[model samples]
Target chain A: MLSPAYLAVAAALLLALGPALPAFAGRPIIAGKPAPSEAAATARWLTAQNTWGFLSTISSDLSGAPFGNVVSYSDGVPGESHGIPYFYLTTLDPTARDALEDQRTSFTLSEFPLGTCGKIDPENPTCAKLTLTGKLKLVDLQSSEADLAKSALFTKHPEMKDWPKNHHFQILKLEIENIFLIDWFGGPKPISPTEYLEYGKNQALLKLS
Target chain B: MLSPAYLAVAAALLLALGPALPAFAGRPIIAGKPAPSEAAATARWLTAQNTWGFLSTISSDLSGAPFGNVVSYSDGVPGESHGIPYFYLTTLDPTARDALEDQRTSFTLSEFPLGTCGKIDPENPTCAKLTLTGKLKLVDLQSSEADLAKSALFTKHPEMKDWPKNHHFQILKLEIENIFLIDWFGGPKPISPTEYLEYGKNQALLKLS
Candidate 1:
């Protein structure tokens, strides 16, 4: 093993090289990815960590084909997740239009982009994947829930606030009814929506006990 | 600007710091991401570079709700792309089973994970997104197309070949009907399936001319 002084010198050298390399060169450390065994924790962790996922809806334009669109979403403000994904979407996009026509939808996220799945095939069970299926509902702008949703969305995606006003962006949330999480071998874990939503609360109670 | 000697020392330091850092520490340089103006090229590039994407299908298990699943897919062997995505799926998974019941499907990919988007938000049109609406069909194992697909899938995903034979993995191809590409602001670019598939050929002809 190298001495502490040697390691310090190496780290200093890396900082010196940082400006000349790519943006990811500094290699900022990411933390808080839950263990695979913590099924509810892992599922909620994925929602909080990822900024974007694929939202699928029944497409009216394609004569009932299932359409999946690349979209940005937020579970809540960073470090204070509530488990329900919220989106700022416009009907000018097909996904929002489809959701209005038919609310049945699913949102999918993968652990591959989180940089924690090191060298594993994305399809590998150990890499982790989540699919939440439910009805997509529009939030009433006047309601307190909408205020919370806007804060959750804007905090994660500052650019959304500056998007074209004429686009008629609306707030939408997934009324999650089914949760499918696969973080290890054997198959997808059986996780109810309530279990997923109340994971943090349950963990707090366990600590207090 | 720094002198050559100083830059060389910094590079040496980065190499030294590599092993102690995370998997993304080395920050492998990615290239060939086309500009937003090259809409067709950008769409094809997203398909060729990504190994997996979200495949959406109408779910029979969930009362016909649209379901999106994380899946591994390959368009072709590296550096020899055919622009038609092929998937290695097992009926044990709901995606394949749903495709059998209803062929209407769409596959979605985003350029955000390619690390070429820089600081741009994923929802920003400039970051690039592609959706291919199509029919999901299984390839007959006896056909020559299956040989090409297997070679393509194996070249990009070697672990796929080692998956258990008892899982009954089968090859499926998307029969693309429509293409939606968003690489710039304004709105989705209208790209026909024919235009997308023939882009490489058209590019070669233009180069020769």
Candidate 2:
């Protein structure tokens, strides 16, 4: 014989935690961050938690110097994370422009901005940093994959939807070829693209989240 | 007569606001951030406030692909920013190793992490983003400049001082040649390195802060 208030609270909790519900434009519910020992889990967790990252590309404007720019990104819309980060970029900016000229790029994310580092210095290995290196490829706006990627990105970054159309903001993603993750002291963890992209598919990570 | 409690409060406020005091490793007392219209002032302000950034360098190990790494940095002791970023890095990391091979590098900082952007998106031009492109040079430990840089770093990141001795962490600084600042709409503001470094020196920015 539970009180009505308690019953209502339980119902809300169930809806929030239920995985079957179609999660939309909101942050995903990560039950708790995975242990540092779980490299793939940690990498996926970092990507899921952060909304923006520093993107590096070979500069066409600066005689091949490495250029880093801060930009917003999303891996998925809430509970349905695909682990492939999608970005809304405009060619007016050098990041998108550089990618057009030379696709070689790296997207770096840090745990510090997530406020989970807990006073640990960002450079500390334990603080966790993930750099996904590969090619930055543009997504065809007419494709269904583009529709999914745009949904994933816009849900995480709602303002992107209202950006001026003249800027020709396009969808782009990192085709991760090499993963460089430093979550602990020994050195960078070697995580293959398959291990990272297919992380949650086996259901091993669902429980942790 | 003023109460002792009130007097103590006043004295503490004065000490915090005093520009003459030698600020050590702690968050700077920026009375307030400069207006976005002030390009040099805004660039210096962003640099002074952030303690860490994403560093991009040409990867010698990854076939000259651009690599970005999260690293802690300091421009000066709290309130006294010199507009040049200093880093404590070990060659064990690809960033430092890459810097040795190719001096070209870019250090990027975002105002979003400072929590001043409010409900605005991180990619919003009003939120501010800065990139300093130049050569990453290792500092001579014996040089007096290293002593100052280390003090600036250790105070902001005290954990760096106790880092394992075997790692051989060395001090490095970015010799800035180009400045890219986006604090408002319409695109990046042009700011010369000299104007950025001399921002506070002329005392034009002190009043704003």
Candidate 3:
């Protein structure tokens, strides 16, 4: 009983919504497919834009075990309010990554133009990404600790109290000695150190400012 | 001593490289300090583009526990292939993902932008993407017990190989009703029927030919 126009409208509507978007409700439409290079660049830009990264590490047991955790972090010393970075993390006695878990650990942080779950952009709702690879080292929050990570943290992220104290609060000073940013779709080139720093700064500003 | 020209070149180099990336090597730059959305997207794109995607499923034991496995996929029709979507997996073998041994599983696939690995382009890497998620299913290979799945897989990846006989090849098919796609920074969004077709098509042809 419906006209062809109706079907066309429906199809057009579907096309406009983009892939896997919520507009279709439960149905997901596959949105922008980045050509390898484009996708990779998009990923680099994402890593540059977003300041927070995930921490994937091998457990203490040395069983080749991988443990992934959502963590909050910063770029500068947690002192002298200037150039400080931090986040509100809710945890309870997370010693391994808690208030006092500064040990040698490897972490990977990445993201791409294609959006994904866990950290969907509330504003854009349709992009997907993930961290390529990086490393994370827990910064000692205690002033006496060797790492200068304490005061700078509380100043920027004042909302720390709002987070449940069940988990010890602390900061992870990022030590990205080497990261292989993969954008197989983009240009399939590794992110240069200079490029990475430039991108990281912008991302930090987004987080702090 | 550092010369003025050296400093100027350093500044120029920094500017050329952008500030996000650092100049010093073996230095860990803080990234994803707050787990921004972009980084998440990069990570997601990597998952989708690297390995072919597969659907994962779980079986319950007598007491109702869950067990699962991630089956490699090669997508496309069996004989005349357009893309490889199925995986070299094991079938009818509960031992691979039986509840007694396993409880959780992950589904992975690569999204090629244009060149290298799963990149779709040769010049840009920011756009590279990979989709990673858990939960998948199995599909009939459309072949005899002695079958090859090279033709079908993650949107027609050129790097994948055909089905392996003795290696226990099982196709990772998704429950169309429960299918979802997430970007690196973008969290899980359901894939609609419309997106399914478009992405399926894109998987076959890099561009809309």
DockQ of each: 0.29, 0.32, 0.02
CAPRI tier for the interface of model 1: acceptable
Backbone clashes per model, in order? 0, 1, 193
| Candidate 2: tens digits of C-alpha lDDT, residues B1-209 | 44445544654664586544322111222236665557888899888888999999999999999999999999888767888999999999999999999999999999988887766788877688999999999999999999999999999998788776777899999999999999766799999999888777856443322
Ranking by TM-score: 2, 1, 3
DockQ ranking from best candidate downward: 2, 1, 3
Model 1 global lDDT (CA atoms, 0 to 1): 0.81
Which sections of candidate 1 miss by over 4 Å? Answer: A1-32, A202-209, B1-31, B202-209
For every model in order, what is the iRMS? 11.3, 12.1, 15.3
Point out the worst 10-residue segment of candidate 2 chain A by lDDT.
A22-31
In candidate 3 the C-alpha lDDT for residue B125 amounts to 18
How well does candidate 2 match the true structure, expressed as C-alpha RMSD?
Answer: 13.4
State the lDDT of candidate 3 residue by residue for B17-51, as single tens digits: 65353211111111221111333333323333333
Candidate 2 lDDT, A99-138, residue by residue in tens? 9999999999998888777777888776889999999999
The native-contact fraction of candidate 2 is 0.75
lDDT, candidate 3, A1-209, per-residue tens: 33345544654676576544323122122333332333333444444334343444433322222233333344333322222223333233121432223233333333322243223221111233333332344445554532434434433333332333433444554444433333221212455445545543433333322
- Once fitted onto the true fold, the runs of candidate 2 whose alpha carbons sit more than 4 angstroms away are A1-31, A204-209, B1-31, B204-209
Is candidate 1 or 3 superior in TM-score? 1
Error of 2 at B115 (Å): 0.3
